[model samples]
Target chain A: MIRTFYGTDTLNSPAAFFIALTIGFFFGLTLERAGFGSSRRLAGIFYFKDMAVLKVMFTALLTAMIGLSFCIGLGVIDPSTEIYFMKTYYGAYIIAGLIFGVGFVMSGWCPGTATVGMASGKLDAVVFLAGSVLGSIFFNELFSIVKPLVTWGQSTQQNMGQEGLAFVYNSLGMSKSAFGFLFTLIAVVCFWGSEYIEQQHSDEIGKTGYFNTPFLRAFSLILMVSAGGLFVLDGSVNAEKHKAVSSSYGLHMSEKALLRDVASAVDHVEPEELADYLSNQDPAVIAVDVRPAKEFNAFHIRGAFNAELPDLPQFVQHHTDKRMIVLYSNGMTHPAQARDSLARMGFRNVYLLTNGLGGFIERCLKPVSLRKEPMPENSIRQINLWRAYFYSFDNARPSVIGSNPSADSAKFSDMPPFLPGFVDADWLAVLMEKPGLKMIDFRDQPEYNTNHISGSYAMSIENFRGVLDGVPSMLMPANVIAARLSLMGIEPVFRFSQKRR
Target chain B: MSSGNQKPYSNPYLAGVFLGVVLLASFLLLGAGLGASSGIARLGAFLSGLILPTHTFSSEYFGAWGEKPLHYYLVFMLLGVFLGGLFSAILSRRVQKSVVEKGNAISSKIRLIYALTGGILVGFASRLAGGCTSGQALTGGALLLTGSLIFLICVFAGGYAAAYFVRRQWHD
Candidate 1:
């Protein structure tokens, strides 16, 4: 398999249906042709009068076994990639198997064979199939009861490499080669035994089942020997060159594309689309109210997810799966600033609402009295709907909180004048993934080691500054900086050629 | 309506070989084994879709396959089985529609009732078993899964024991 789940994903696609139909056509034909379409023939196994079921099942199982073992050795089969296995499920399986077995003997049909019977015009099969479906529905409807029952036997029984017989032999401290040899011997014994039993009943049935002429038998013998030899000679059914690549999942959007997407989203979001997304609770679209926590809790859009600018990076990083994040605030500034920060981080799906709540109310739910003139029918209906949820005609009033001048937000305004090009955590995270960019952590090594963001290199602030000759903190000389960088194998700053500059 | 010149069914060994080849080809080509149970289960869910569409689509068990219940490959295969079986039965003249198939010791009425009862039980049990004869017994057996083999033995043991008690149902 190219990667995990690749096998099933290939089968689950649209074109695989034709292959499924073709495979099914042959599968159905083979089942029906083998006398499996009739319950009397099937039920005969219980009576020991007809050994067809055992012969058929055992033969098929062994055949696939040999074929798969060979394929695995030849690197053509990867068991985990293709074949599916459920958990050990000991409790559920045993009980279910007992009940299914009872049903199998009584009905004389299992689910698969019953389908074949129905196809061959057996009315009983139809009833069985219908009843099975109803039974499934009943199980689902009363899931509360069945959930606990099924989960009781949850245990990991994964065999080493999940190889067929190799697992059992490996568990028993036997080499896979010996297991293969023993496996071949067992299959031969079973084959011979089934033949002996079937031959006893050959006279009653029309067919002798001895399709293996001398040459065919010899050929099959060779095939079996080769299958066994391959398992021993090469290995079990696991991939030889098993390689899994761990991804450093950083979005690698091109600058042009990033600018185009973020620029478009940041400029405007239509009122109707935002309303529709929020109303339907569309999973792909997340609404972020960029307002403060206090304002968000007081009143906000019904389904909008809230986050301030400081916490937006972690929130966005946590939620990144090609989702569109819509940001809105009281006015345009907050959302516009947040969207820009996200855009620098190569996130293309972050959008700023074109207008704030005031614009939304004016455009989406303007009262007829407030309207300059006549309004459209749809607008009138939308206004009425908005009125129902948001407008309590008798008591509707906006909560007013006078601005607190000394609030925490004033800290940003009063910051030192020298720090102009401030990059937030969101932008820095994106820069970390870039090939040529470097993030020098201005913290102690222990602080960096504790839990720094991935891809940040530690560099102490103490190393960059020193007390120079009884003076307070002073920067290192250019020559000292050059020598320090040279020791670390980093290129020192170079002056541009005057003409080129 | 008996066709005197109708071809007999293939030899069991020959048919078994063909079945094995088909099973092997499925593993190689599709990374899956031959199965009919899940197809039927999905069909069951599809039927339930008409009655309880929301519950049918949202229920954790059935909903995993998403909105369309009949979209799985097994369902298509089941249809193919139906078509193939119909074609084979038509070619062999085995398509006579009758309500009963019982032996001399048992009346057709009693056998029919038993058949319906048995059918319901098997249907319900197959879901619980996570598979039926083809899926668990044949496919899992081929894979040599411990659980599948155990289930196989239990099914046979349960069937054999049950058959002893109901010998009259098939005795002729």
Candidate 2:
């Protein structure tokens, strides 16, 4: 089978070397930007003065691993497409890694950093580099003698090598998803542990002002580019698969008819239609409350059957022909959300109570008790018509739109209206024409590789987030975002689309 | 100048990611991951071959190294690494000549000696194993290589163990 470009095939010889050099340069730049070249700064890890290293590394790894696993779970890329570095002399690598780690902590410089140190005019770094070269030569000379011991009694066939943690996980009979979950849990624990350690030794490490350095910034940019490369490669290969999974997941969650906030509510229906349902419903029309049990118990519409969210599927399955399954939530959003989810599982006639329970109370229940003010009637009719139209098509299960089922699935969503604000083909073309707009697509590996908006560089969102400190919240400070963008050659003034949100 | 008194370093997490990407790219373009020792080894082999060709070729260890050309892929990669590092340092205006040793602890001479010794030990250990710390620990660890994990754990353990004895070298 012809595997995609983002995997091992992408790392072939000259390409790999060039990639390494380019990435290395950027990595060095980011390291400097992050203040990595200074030994005292690095020693902060040991003294517990700072824990940026721990936070950034674990987050990056977790993000990438999670994204990778999601892609695998969605079957966008075959898990076995790349060769993981596992077949070598295990004993040798372990011993080497341990020694290297010790050297790292003590000297505050690894092989990579020592060179960067040399570049920054640190004589010690230069000396260290010299030592490394000599060390490598010594190893080469001694290789013949150590070859037998290196191989030991390990099977020769095992030398064929494995790829990623999945092989180890599969060998242990655990599912990839389970392993991914476990790894994430462990990483979170490690993150917490690092923080605790830093807190414990806060005084000794002092306030290390390393966060805003040029070295670190440059280092982050390099990572961003590398991630971009991966994203472009991976996105192109599995864009459709990702779209499919996201849509499917969206649909499944939608069935609960629960809206977390008002924004989601506004996306579906107006308030007046829900008022109409309250006035028109017959006594026999079973109004099922499909929110959480706690929510139902706290306060729900009067005369509503308490059916919890998870139980809705089972309830729908058991009660095939109920008079009218009118699902209501706190707002108009939940009902619309729930309708999609229920429809995916073969449920039909799922209706969102327009205006939700709030609307019903204001429009229908209030009129019976007190003299009510006159309300506009046209808005009520529009709401009813909207609800009726959706309910009619509820049974039409059209194979769940936006779910990519084939390897060769064309990205129909890549069309004009669906283009991301900063990353449309036209926007990219314009940016490319500019001196230095540097459009970066922060998607996953497969999606970017398959077909990114033309001229936009692919960088996995995980990598970008990793190097950028963390994922930027929707309302993050613009300056911080701009600073990050500047590192990637993107202008601070470029308007980014908020549509993806 | 006192290393401890010097400005602190960049965030390691970010650095690690940067390092990972470089390694990834090396794998993609060069069909090999990053290795510091190999570059050093090639240089050593070449130097030894030129200085004492007969002895270098005859020796069990050094002899095998001299068989290969000096300017191999690893040598070029290492050269690029130095250039890249230099470029970044120059651009950032961080280039300044200085000796980096811990503050007011061990004298400069001792620090240099220790650095040399540490380098040699790390170098030997890297050879004993198939790759160096970067290759095995960061790169391999990210890839979830079992040996790499073991190596990373051991490095921490070893460093901590040695740290206590070497406190004089760093602690004020």
Model 1 steric clash pairs = none
lDDT of 2 at A180: 50
Candidate 2, residue A148: lDDT: 54
Q: lDDT by residue for model 1 over B1-172, one digit each (tens)? A: 4347756776665677788888887777766777777887787788887887766766656755555778887888778888877778777777757544456898876766677677666666667667777777787777766567777888887888788766677777
DockQ of 2: 0.20
lDDT tens per residue, model 1, A1-501: 322222657666556777778888888888888877888888888876676787678767777877777676555656654666644456766777787777777777777777778877776677666767766777667665676566445434434222122244534566555665666566555656656665675557565544345743764586467556755555432232121101112355444444444422434576656766766667898888888888677567766778989999888988788467888888988887777777667566787776776666666556654553234465578777765655443223334222233333333323223323344344444344756455666644434443466776767665657767877569877777666655545565332333236
DockQ of each: 0.27, 0.20
A431-498: candidate 2 lDDT, tens digit per residue:
35455445577744333443456667755343323323464424345676666666667665322345
- Clash counts per candidate, in order, are 0, 76
Clashes of 2: 76
- Strongest candidate by lDDT: 1
Model 2, position B79: C-alpha lDDT score: 64
